[model samples]
Target: MKTVIRYPILFRAHPGRTEKPKDVLVPYLHEHDVPEISEAETHIAFRSQKYALVEYDGRLFSKVGKPGSNSAEACFGHAFEKEELRRRPWWIPTIEGDKVYIRYAGQPLDNLAYYRLYLDGGDKARETMIWPALTPDYQRHLGGPRSRNEFTFQGLVDKIRDINGVQFDAGREEHRAEAERLIVIDGSYWIETTPPAICVAHEGRMIVELSHLPNWLDHDLGRQYFPLTAKDEAIEYARRAQAITQRSEEPVRNFADWTDFRFDDNPLFAFDYEGYSLKRTTFLLGGDIARAMTGNGEIEGKIGSARARAVLSAKEGARSCGADYRTWPDASDLVHDVTDAWKMTGRKPGWTEIPPKRHEFGTMICERAAQMADSMPISVSARSTWTTSP
Candidate 1:
């Protein structure tokens, strides 16, 4: 199993006026900022001094107790129950907008756009998403609203208990306004928290998944087909991709060749070789590279899966899902289970246009009809032995 890396980090709340409830930006502190967190919880003096928030996979805790209040002193009071955690919807509020900061929803996000999704401007309250998990202590620390029954939580505790707390008090605008942003969502954030073993897709679209703290040091399952930046890490990926262009032979110049790397006009890429060991094909932009699969211009442009070659669909869907078939077979069961869940819950559970793991081959065979030259050597189609996967 690939280990998910965790940063030894802390969140320190910036001091501001406490008169009215408002959002405060919390800065990320390196481990050295609070060296005590590195040791055993029982060994460290948790309440020695009111410490900053310690974070892991999103669930947080502090080192101090509330003054003159009848409350649990620290994290020891909370229950570590997946039983309950699996029931509540997990949400990541948009960073910035000066309203909320930092977000990490459970993996396999329903929409790819929401993986790193952000909200702009800090004016409106409706733009921000709310989670009931905000404890009074955390809210006070965060300088956010103190309604534990915020968002869908009120519906969970009050509305169902025959208490109309969600209703307006004498047509109070405040009450009605809060209700508007309170989006009621079902199913827990859990269902699937761990990243999939291999990239899995449902039908044609790729399934978007996330992992804890996807930074430069971490394995970012959440960031796929985004872009290869000029950062040091990206250069490594660019190296491997460039190597493909200089592979067994240079790509045919006169026609589009599948056996060789085909660069595209606008490229969307991912740095996945580190974990997946899959071949990274660089899609360069060239007029010859855009030739139709059929020798005859019977079909106007690249059709079927070929249509996915250069743009968003290919990187986000194909490479993101590990169509290269280089997954660690020992743990292939995880991929199977994730795919099954995706299919059963997908838009078309009955759809069968897609075949087995070799799904790409058949489609390519029919769509691909490219070669070097007509009178010379045979046009090398990407033909492979037909095999079935268990």
Candidate 2:
């Protein structure tokens, strides 16, 4: 489940000459090009880098840039760094060998200079950050001294209301003229221009990879471990949704507290120096059990409302994955949604959907389990120290 925030953007479009409308495969538009194209605009917040950079040449064929000619979806690709190209840019399907360009229809800058990046920032924060971080010369490419203008921070756009409606052709010349006049006032799309750094994991579910991230905080290491940093967002969300409200949601999970047992083993890293990706830490040890009990799937249906579903989930999770959820800090919400779904569904609280797993937290490791089974008293160290020794 996902919600996209969209806004209006001014886009240039090339309606092919009635004779060759489909032949307009334009990437960069210039005034010096054969002819002019039409313009459309709108927004996507919670998204897109709303800023557009248009540079026009007052000199010569600066008069002939046909930007919208390549309006078809087939002509563009992503503006990936050399490192990203090898990774199969999330948006581009072409392998490293396929030649393609980033698709940008942000605005109609026809009859203008030629530049490839139309609406940059598909790389999310990494891509969007480039705009604000540009040096004075490039940042002030707007020509005059408007205090080095950047893409103006236009406000958010409501994707639901400010939407692009049906597409229709300009049937007849007179009809086209009337349509143009009507569209100016009553169009499906707004005439303007912009997810946070979020990506749907390959499992095909909406996982918020970022939130509240200031682009300036991004650097080499942050970028390198983005796959890990994203975990912070996920963990935070998990805390909010499942952790007990009264207790501090500061992470208490074992993995979250584990120091590097060994760095070279790659337990704490997303990618090695050689660019080889490593196994990412899997944090949700118990949630999957709940999901399994309720028969919920990544894309399929499940029982109950969000809270009810959560309740069912938590109880089910707590029942089977007892070892992890028995007293888990975050299990509160799940067990309730973390409380009532099971009861609401007429299932008893003592219900065990699966074989129960027990948390040994009440006892110490190595000796406590055997001691508890043998009915031996647990011994405590006289000096309360954090160290563990045999």
Candidate 3:
């Protein structure tokens, strides 16, 4: 997928203006006609020089008057350079191969003229660095100094915001509120862009950009809605969500210590649960356990197959243990299956053992189970007496 940024202002130049140049000039000089030398001595005189101005057919051209000047050598040199010089240079007429040639050994007049006109201004930096780097194609794209597509860094922030329709401050608050309303309507959602990046909100209060997060952590928080719980376990749940998304590594050693990086306390990450209940807690817990067990930590290899097996195993275990509670499996049984599958697959079992005495949810599950068992009647009369007393 192509990368997307939340605010387009982060890029160096406007997208519309940064296109590659089309009219880049070729580096090497082109072939041109050589002027005839009037005599052998003239050819010999200019043979030692690299360049010469030649007068030929009442017109002048710059020709390569290299050594061993023969008639055939007169037809080749840079045509562009000759044009730039206005066909004027001091020359001596000579004969070579019985044809007249003009040879002059001097600096390229056109280049000197160009330097005097364009480079004479106090823009040494542009001449020395920028101008040299610009190819003929780029120069054509530039079209000159007054072209509309020229890039400028000034007022860039406002320009970016205008182009991308991004909100800030008070406007951002409204956007955040809308996001929270949408999340409550659905469970969770992704805010997509052309070049994609992931950003999430919590309770319309905090926004986090997953792109800035570690790859493992970002993948772990796979686009999903989380259940709200007590602060500690909610954070733990978020961490586990990340781990489940990871599917390759052992469970985190100290989930509490993990950081929850946020961009700001904007409405973008807000939640509205004024009428919600805690009944789904068990199911959410079961889902988390199932997710945690499925894959090895590695990003590549047979993660898909492993996760499939883990899910199947968890379901089977839940059924055998009579733990499936309609919408979700039993949390305890799910955790057990997940750990067993991880061990079977030669992966680290990251979660704490079940029937956990100190674990927050584990202790809750055990206490709840014990309470139910105690409430059951030992005999028919005992059940009747308890019912009557209640």
Candidate 4:
């Protein structure tokens, strides 16, 4: 199997009024502003102070927690889970329109993050908060909400402030409306609280615009087609298609010449090789390149089994399925299936009428016809070979 290497990168948040969230954007933001920020940033301490930023088109949501004053952890955890990280490089939620940033550990965010966000009040309340797993003393240091049922949104918020090391809600003390349509969320941030997440730091707010996320549910599979970017891929597609429909050639052309022929004193048939060149070419050719045994104009446009071709000019309903001579079961099956389907549907599956007028043989056809002129060619006529009138 071929291998592909994908490197993990972090986004950061910009400084503003409110303190940056530790679990999301602040860490990434630091890296963008810092020098030599790499994947290792999330693993270090002093260098892991950076952060990233991202703005999402959709809303960020949080999960609902179990009943209790300690529900804050559950709330934040839920929010974390709701963040569709895999879909977005980073995400930013807005509170009253102010941007709130979020990022990942060295690990990439998955579908679970989006689920967590919805669980939090982030979607409904439109508030931004962070949940730090690395802050060992965070719970001990920070207190809970006012009531048992009321989770301490302030505690996580405060922790985000201390660790994130950036202020996005700076001058905008009050909520403001977005400008035009391309509004930016340079107002929130995050910070690294522990080991795995440490590598996420060492960068400034990494900008992640949520509007760019992909919506898989809306993707239309019906319109999807295989890309022919490589020569091998194209060849493979053709080979698979050929395996489906048994044909002498990948592309069937010249239906009249796709058969065997012999020059016999059969008064009902006459082979017509317009020129001498085709006579020679046909004599040397063994497969479909050879002309039909009986020359009849009606067979020029017919496509059917050898048996069907043999009796084509004799009678309309006298043709056989040619199953005995078929090498591939699939070919016989298709012919039988199509024939049966057409019979049952009261519709003919193929046309056996010759064109009203033939094109000028030109040099190409002249050269080919000349080669076969000396030999009696195979012909699969749809009508009687004894008649010359249309």
The C-alpha stretches of model 3 lying farther than 4 A from their native spots are: 1-313, 316-326, 348-390
Better of 1 and 3 by lDDT: 3
lDDT of 1 by residue, 1-390 (tens): 111111111111212323322221111111111112222331211111122223222222322222222221111112111222312222222122212111222111111111111111112222132222324456666776454222232233332222223221211332222112111112101111111111211222223211121211111211222122223333332232323332313321211111122212221223333333211111101011122111224322323233323322212222132111233121111222222222222212110123222233222211211110111233346558856778
lDDT of 3: 0.26
Expressed as tens digits, the lDDT of each residue in 230-293 for candidate 3 is: 2343444445333323232434233212233222222222332110111122222322334343
lDDT, candidate 4, residue 382?
77
Error of 3 at 253 (Å): 19
Worst window of 10 by summed lDDT in candidate 4: 194-203
Q: Model 2, stretches more than 4 Å misplaced?
A: 1-66, 71-95, 98-390
Q: TM-score of the candidate numbered 4?
A: 0.15
Q: Point out the higher-scoring one by lDDT: 2 or 3.
A: 3
- Backbone clash numbers for all candidates listed: 5, 55, 39, 124
TM-score-wise, the better of 1 and 4 is 1
What TM-score number comes out for model 1? 0.19
The candidate, 3 or 4, that scores higher on lDDT is: 3
User: 48 in model 3: Cα distance from truth in Å?
Assistant: 80
> What lDDT does each candidate get?
0.22, 0.23, 0.26, 0.23
Q: Write the per-residue lDDT of candidate 4 for residues 1-390, one digit (tens) a residue.
A: 111111111122222345543234212111122112223222211111122222122222111122232332232222122222333322222123433233222222222222222223222321133332213244554673322123323333443334322322420110011101111122212222211100010011111111212111101111111111222332343343333332414442221122222222322111121221121122111111112212323333343445343223222111111111111111211222222222232221111111111121112222323333324355566765576667
> lDDT score, residue 341, model 3?
39
